[model samples]
Target: MMLKLRVDNQEIEAREGKTLLQACLDNQIYVPNLCYLEDMESPSASCRMCFVEIEGTPQPVPSCTVQVKNDMVVKTDTPAVRQLQRTALRLLLSVHDVDCKNCHANKKCELQNIAKFLKVGLKPKRLERYLKETLIDETHPFLIHYPNRCVLCGKCVHICRGKHGESVLTFARRGFDTIISTYSATDESSLTCGDCDTCVKACPVGALAVKESS
Candidate 1:
């Protein structure tokens, strides 16, 4: 069955029961999303980039987690939506080091595109940028981790547990002390990881990365 929805003041249709993000993509709405990798079965809802306004709702909701309904009205690019998106982008950028000029993801990063779209201004709050030692796993031979760039979005853990049947990676500690590391005291290099790379691909902010093959 097909469902009709209003997005960005335009009427669009998509398959019923599919997620709003799927509906928007089907209709070319092009919502920016970080926690929603198209091929990944997991929906982490951590990045909050795919937020959209619905008629009669008080605040914008995550499109990736919302299901489409017939006659529903959705607003993806309204002024309020834009402002919220800008704020969200600013928050994500706040924790990240925006060294795009020299970073590997430079021109190709999704967060960079969102930053450009949001036209992020100088942050209202200032703090020291903490840089952690990058986590490297020689046992996997295909992955790299820069915890400083990680936004704690949990996409990697979701991918590992959801798609690979491996629960090797988990977040430890709490609050500002939280970091993505392997279960218990073992490191990623020592864990019997399958090296699926799903976690690397699911990361929205370049936290987990792939080493270019030589």
Candidate 2:
């Protein structure tokens, strides 16, 4: 079955059951996305970068999780859409440093690409760097942790708990205090982490990662 939908004022037909992101990519719309694994069934919608305005819908929709429907009209680059996307990116950047020049993923980071695409220079909100920095554990020999740069996107949590059978990481605490930490905040090498690196790879930002050794 094919579903007819409009994106950015252009009408196109796509597979009925595919997600909106899949449909857009299939149609070559290039909807910006991060924290979305290319071949995974999981649609975490953690980054909120693929938001689009759907006809008859007051609020924006997450294209990654939304299934295409007949007569669905979407506005991907409208003023409202841009504003929302900028807001989302700004919020994410608020918790993150603007030091892309010296970062590991300087040229390869999705968050940086999205920020560039949205033309976001700096967040409207004041920057308040956290005083307490999370430690980096290199004992696992496969991954590193830099919680200071974490945006609480839940991508790591999704990949750890969904793609990998081992539930090593999860969101602990709540609200401003919320952070992604291993279950019981225990040492990763001491547990059943499997060291798959799926969570680290799924992370859009450099929160959880396999650091390059010198």
Candidate 3:
């Protein structure tokens, strides 16, 4: 059954089981999100950029993880929501490569786009930028994985797991030193990047890409 909900003072028709993010997007509403994929379960709500104010909630909640309900009231552009999003985005940018001009993703990058949407500069404002050692894995024949460009959204990991039975791309390490990785390989034959580009297509940012043949 279709449900009616109020989003930012606009009444929108959303389906019974759709998420708040899905409902908002279906209505052409713009919500800054980096971790929600359409066909996949939110494997990790690590991005923390989709916060919205729901009626009766003391704290802003991530919209991607909330289901839409009849008569539900949601405020997407509230001061609290903006603050949460701004802080989350600044943190993401702080550790990001921030080399947009030479980066392959460039104009098509989600991080860049969301930053623009939020009116936040890519340069670290109140926070200091932390640059980790560049990790480029070209072991796979068809693709290159740049850990620096990744936002840890897990889109690539979910796509790999969804398309195939196993997930080759995965999160490694913990806390401030965390990163994404695949199974370690003793030789080139052990690498499992497969021929499909599902992960690349699913990636909101251009962190993963096709390796040009030499």
Best by lDDT: 3
Candidate 1 wrong stretches, greater than 4 Å: 38-42, 121-142, 183-195, 211-214
Error of 2 at 38 (Å): 6.5
Q: Count the backbone clashes (under 3 Å) in each candidate.
A: 0, 0, 0
Ranking by TM-score: 3, 2, 1
lDDT of each: 0.72, 0.73, 0.83
Cα lDDT for residue 191, model 1? 53
Q: Give the alpha carbon lDDT tens digit for every residue of 74-136 in model 2.
A: 888878778888878777777675667756667777777787888987444565544225545
Estimate the overall C-alpha local distance difference test score of candidate 3.
Answer: 0.83
Model 2 lowest lDDT segment of ten: 131-140
lDDT of 2: 0.73
Instruction: Return the number of clashes found in candidate 1.
Output: 0
Instruction: Candidate 2: give the clashing pairs.
Output: none
Candidate 3 lDDT tens digits, 1-214: 9999999899999888788998999999999888788775543567898899999999999888888899999999999899899989999998888888978889999998999999999997788877667668775667788877888888888878777777878888887767767646325466555466788888888788888871
